[model samples]
Target: MSNVLAIAGVTRILKDMLNDALVFGNVDQVMGTDFAVTAQPPDRIVSDNPDTQTPHLNLFLHRVTPNAALRNADLPTRSGDGALQMRPTLALDLHYILTAVAAEELHAEVLLGYAMQLFHEMPVVPRESIRTSLSAAELAGLGSGLPDFGTGPLSPAELADQIEMLKITPVALSMDDMSKMWTALQASYRTTVAYDVSVVLIERALPVRPTLPVLTRGGLRDPETGRDPGVAAEPHLATSVPSLLSVAAQDQHPVMRLGGRVVLTGTGLDTGDAQVRFREAGTDVSLLLVPEAPARPDRLVVQLPGPAALPGGSSLAGTPQDPASWRVGAYEIEVILTDSEARTAATNRLPLALAPAISATAVAGGLARR
Candidate 1:
């Protein structure tokens, strides 16, 4: 009778072999029976049994037997000894068995592949084809047996939508359109736009590092000796408030509609009762106060009425006899700000030019000419 030894811990040994194979490249001894078979060492010999110098190699053999109905003959009786009387079969190779196990556990195969790639420096195989190769039942049970593994939160469609929304397109604008936009910006606000020629002149006259007013915790510091001899000090002091001025124009020709806010920055000056006057070009003395804001020192808020129409009976023809034909010229109006001391804290003198309103008839004629 052939003796067989059941491998008590083959599963754990196999798992260790797989883990070590991922960490180390040598698999020479892993394939040998020495790791699985339990027996005396090869160097040891039995003293009483000289013929059996080395111990017999214990082997674990497994075979699948099929059950079927037997004919009317008497069946074999069980042996009195607790051993089976059935014939034994050879076991399959461990590597082949492991391959079969991986095929049976598809998710384990994927996880093994990923682990091998990470630990063994193996090339990665794409997951899509592997997923497609799995059967419906196998795919359903892939991650279900695992206690903590989870399918991701976002669906493929949602990811695709987010990716599509991330793409951006740039918008382009022409110079004339940009100018019109700036004009609209100024027209939307009631504040005056003027050329600060005085600032430009002053900047040209002053040195690179100019003196400014000094403010201290105690109060304003004395100008002559504000710092100790050994201490470093700032070169410039704050004096006049920086102001920006520019020409303002109606965004749309004929000023059909207009209505937005003006931002001003300054110090030591009150804008209480600040007024912006708009006048016909070329006339200085006869100017109309277009808008006015009640005393609010340091900041002024103003609003201009909308849907302004050109002066009545304006003509496009440049005839000197026609008041409308006389195009608007420079130095027409000014913006003035008054402080508590009744002083003119800030002033912006603006030069303006008004273009003659174009009529529908002229547009039609121009199209005909074209």
Candidate 2:
């Protein structure tokens, strides 16, 4: 996704493309003078002294609307618990009024015709052209660089690298529409053509909620009965802190791996804010992990830190998980529940055996038969 500079980047690319075409097409030789391409308001282009204004084309972004195809593509960006699931994007279609400014008769018409032809010939802006336009410090000798306009070098590659290639389409503006727009801008109506540059996506790289890998599907299968034992509910006997009945790896292995997930079956285990505690056996040092959403009162799923870093592993709480925090040993697992009153209570600790995952590269030699 692109950043906030995407809009300005698109405008810059269009202005530069037109300016280049004019230069290569040698419109100056045909018109017998210098021509300019600019990105400015229509009102700002016109002046009291008409003779001083040069024959030029001005790109003015008159309106911005959402792209109909991708407007709602990134919906449900956040989970029910208000955690960000994905980065939201703003897809936009830029409506521009390309106005030709020339006091002499037929000069504006010539410039407008040439600009329209250029847009028609080249419908889509090439990705490399976009990169070159945004990176350059100037456009068409008009000094219409990006917004900052020469403070320092800008990194607008995201705009160029966006998935949707910017396409130029002619917009047929009715006579009333043109009259209303020019009147609103308070500028004299010149030979103007409307165009739409579509699908400029702008999104920010915000941290999102990390999810766990799928362990077991459906439920644990009974060894003797060969039937899955789905989740069951048990009545809470009394009002007290949450208590754990059993702790097992979701994969049903004898020992849990560093990066594996564990399921805690207990009573009164769920709350709005629930964290699973993994304490090193016989030590006060421990780590707390927030459970995934869709809270359940009888079950809690928690992921254990891996032996090495994983994607977005540090984004859980903005703290990197150190491999030293977890090792091949016994850990006492418990669930901490926080109530609406801001009080917290932890459940009884249950034992879990965590083991180190062996790698083929780490082995000194191939295994030999005993």
Candidate 3:
């Protein structure tokens, strides 16, 4: 839950930690010279005048990789139109190489040993240590050795407030990898050790669209009946389960048009008080149609309402002036069966393409009537 500055904050904290340890642990006093801690690249550490260069410990961030455990934790965080649906976080792991430099013999090795020991003794960086190391000179002591009196432009205090603690562990590099890394740097190899810092979470600060809590599990109960018809117990059987094979127009046309009859071919379709349900795709609108009398077990016929009301009663109808209730698009067709005892079950849903009926046509500079 930190900001983008967390990565730089980590490097700054490590540099300060080493600087403090060297000064307070009396390593510089025993060596009779000051030991400097830097976060510069290994190639940049090389200087022409080695005698003037003091004993130094450099922390170079070599590579950054995604944390495997929480890499995809924030998937599907955006909507179809690319609007923010939820807050997204980036989890990362940082790899660094700690190298020591000195002109005198054995000084570089001693510095490297101290740096490794400091990390080993404190495997996990404490929140208090981070806050203190990144604090300003007025808040901390003047000896606090960081750019701009400890609080740089990176705003590293955000790192201390993160939820996950930073862990430092040693990484074993193969000789081939070491050789390639040095060759890439093009600098003389010094006493170096690799360390891994993990779980730096950088989150985006943006408004998210949150859904309202559900007030009811299903539809509201009837005022008089005190029961919800939306609840039903559907039967699941290994054999003789109601399923739809195909739904096509009466003339075997692939598309169904207004004022046309469609035949439903399936098994176990005939049941108590059965009706065909049409659900428009991508919408909650539904239309129900009653089957013809003397229903067949494996087939049923339903007539779509025309511009005028049909002879037999139908659930819905469309007119030339008003066709709002009927939309020409794809729909899901399913058979709903309800018994006398109010027990209801539905068959599998299949796709149904509803086509618009063209009764008249008008073109530019001309008009035609059908």
Candidate 4:
């Protein structure tokens, strides 16, 4: 990006661009060293003062407006070092009036035409092409560029290497507006055109630390629910969890039998991204019962896995008796939201029983009932 250039620097850059236009436009002979630049109130152009009665292009700054998008953004250093200093860069849109002056109509029209052509062909000024200062000898060769005659020091251009390309767009003014403008300037209107130069940025000079990137994210959260990480037992708080209302089979009989679809109804279950847990009662062998299906706020349609399909089946768990495995047993149903960084809360444990209606086996007594 380019370093901050003051208003004077901007004026210098514009003058150079216009000067180059006349030189390379092959109209050097026509617009010779006689070309002039006057103050905004170009009364000199019509004055008896010989300095004003020359072939010239008058550049006047008409307006300056702030760039809206660049306004009010936080500074990079504000977040660092706990500093409240907000050193924001000011982006400005510059409007300029380029008017051609000459006693002859053709000469004035030709100069204005060349200026328009130059800006049209090179709408954006590149970094390398910007110049801070041009020597008297160089100006003499260009047929333009007046030497600094004011008592003040010479203001040099400093807009080189700015990140944004200086874009020039033509302004369309209404007839009444244009007339009022010329009258307001108190100068006779000549062949003139308006151009807007954008994104002239001036950065703050305050001492600030460089903006740093976020290195890490804190805490663990279940991305699905934006809730706390699932835990083995309880929630972080007792009051915040989804309160389990009821879990019932969707069938007409409404029996919570294994392998049947059941709807878990709850109060706080509406929080997006939660889980319904069917934990084996009286054991630490808890498995995530909620399927990878979508979660709802008030209810969840889930299919209970059969005993054989229960997480870590009894047969595979141990030889004879796997106390933790699901079988003909009682379980606790819970709705949980694990917002790790925030909190982990689960509804009160609700009791659920898994039962087989009837089982027959050929035993010593032909059938076994136990």
Candidate 5:
């Protein structure tokens, strides 16, 4: 996976490659005008003034479409600081229109053909080439303002290091699409070829590492002795809360919509005067939104507010935008077993997914659009 500037870096690297591939490896030779190879949009490149006009090769990125198969691809790297950092990466297809603008018609055709020829011959961009050509700042990121990776001075070699060799392939554009392309750019049609650069990785900056805040206790009492030295052995769990294994029937799903029903599956759920409690994900407050459900020994069925009869004939479907809303994210669930004559005990946290569906019906013209 590459850093934030990998996309722009790929464009710069390509420009460099084509310039080097030109006859005698010269930069100011294409079409007698300055070989101005730019990645900017054609709309922004065009100007009304004739004095500043110059023939050039514009490798304009018309579109950036994400690769569906690797949409959620990530790198699980243990940071030097011991944080289990999940470095996220998005695979994308860079659609570039290699447009050649020249006063001489023949020169424009020659420039476009040469650009196509270069890519056809060197279809695969080598790691060594990208590593040697692109600087660390260009490969990792551009400016201090763009904190898209939150990483500190990543090396050039690490850019596009985890992904496959960047492949350049010609994309067939019909006459209609060609017309639309020129129309959208609001520029005159020029000799051009559409090419797709596969899998330029762009990583996000948000932190995804949060280590286990609490470990084993400092001292643990042995079964025979009252207490012992050193941290307690693993599985030194206190029975103050419950731990949930999963949700949905047979644990096949993890999400349930506001009006949908789901099964909260786990262990140690049985208790006197048993009732399941719901709390928002990232919050610790006394007030909770409890869903009406039939609490059982191993499972509890809950239906988000509708025609369901709750303990006190109360049900709720919190507002949509609020993360604490029943329509939003995961809700932490706990089973409370309190016997007035005996004692009261609550289990560990078990998150009840409020919205995202597991069968992914949500993605298939479902809530995925939302």
Candidate 6:
């Protein structure tokens, strides 16, 4: 068989051993009552030399179960083997161990020693000792065919160092070790049926934000008054604003609430018609609002609800209030602005704060004076 195939076979045997170990030794520990084990075969193999008789294989072991109890257990309690089970909650731990054994320094030495033993006809020489005695071209030629002493470039020490750099420690298993582990496992489980095992490790990806940009408002004039909207608008006025902001986010159907005070301001904007809404954003939350008619040239201000433990910070445009000190859970404010039609031009969204209570207070305080 080809060296690559041999490596694959070795991995398969090792995985089977692991599964048997779990099943027989500590069926309760490894899989609990409801879990199932699956085997994923080697996807690739790497050899130290092109003509080397042995190579290393990569394998995956996967455990599947619908048991919520098992899923919720801590890492230490979740392994397939009861006594031997390490913390199984973290999938990364399995990957680390596997990678360490498969491609790491420990395995590299073991594989090299094993390959030399297997290929009795080929001369076995340390890579470093050979490198010192031979030139690059000579070493290349030596590595091409039957191994010769003093012809390969890298010394054993240097090769070992390179293996260390690769962070290959002690994860994968050899065929013999695989057999031993499997024997122990099968005996423990008392199962004669063949089983497949596959192990997968995955990292959760971050959520993506919407591609659409926030809407903008351009300068426009009042047709009835024929005055610059800026001049005619009111300042520091409260107007009722809608609570929801992004329509796309709303599709998630997040629970909404009036999180804090909602207000609108501009030359002519008042506090009556403005409304505000809140929705969940991952672990945190966001607020959106729309101001009433009688739009202003100046920007509008929206504040997040503050908590008592205000982190020594406040909103940009409003007065900071201690969230804990306030007896009321809900507060409302409003702003009146010209309808979208009345304004010569404007964008859809008005900026709002998604900060903590203290930060929101700091922000509101800063913006209130502007």
What lDDT tens digits, residue by residue, belong to model 2 across residues 1-370? Answer: 6788888888878887888888888888888888888899988878679987788799999999999999999998998999899999999999998999886778888888778998999899888887677654444354565455334434565687889999999999999999999899988888788999998999987888788985554445667987765544556665445788999999999778877788888778775489888888877878877777777878888776676654554554333255556656888888888876466888888898788777544334765432
Per-residue lDDT, model 6, residue 108, is 36
lDDT of each: 0.30, 0.80, 0.80, 0.64, 0.64, 0.32
* RMSD values, in order shown: 35.4, 22.7, 13.3, 13.8, 19.2, 23.3
Mark the 10 consecutive residues where model 1 has the least summed lDDT: 195-204
Local accuracy of candidate 6 as per-residue lDDT tens digits, 122-240 = 22223343233233354455342223322343222122211111111233455675566546444221111222222212212223333567343334655787654453343544432
Per-residue CA lDDT of candidate 1, range 3-62, in tens?
111121122222333444433533223322111122222222122444322212111112
Q: What's the TM for model 2?
A: 0.55
Worst 10 residues of 4 by lDDT: 149-158
Identify the candidate with maximal TM-score: 2
- Show model 2 residue runs off by greater than 4 Å: 136-143, 147-154, 211-370
Sorted on TM-score, best first, the list reads 2, 3, 4, 5, 1, 6
**TM-score for each model:** 0.22, 0.55, 0.54, 0.53, 0.47, 0.19
Whole-model alpha-carbon lDDT for candidate 1: 0.30
Taking the candidates one at a time, how many backbone clashes does each contain?
7, 0, 0, 10, 4, 96
Off by over 4 Å in 1: 1-244, 250-270, 279-282, 290-327, 361-370
What is the Å distance of residue 183 in model 1 from its true position? 82
lDDT of 4 by residue, 303-351 (tens): 6554443255445454212323445667787776766345567778777
Judged by whole-model lDDT over C-alpha atoms, candidate 6 comes out at: 0.32
State, as a TM-score between 0 and 1, how close model 3 is to the true structure. 0.54
- Scored against the true structure, residue 215 in model 1 reaches a CA lDDT of 39
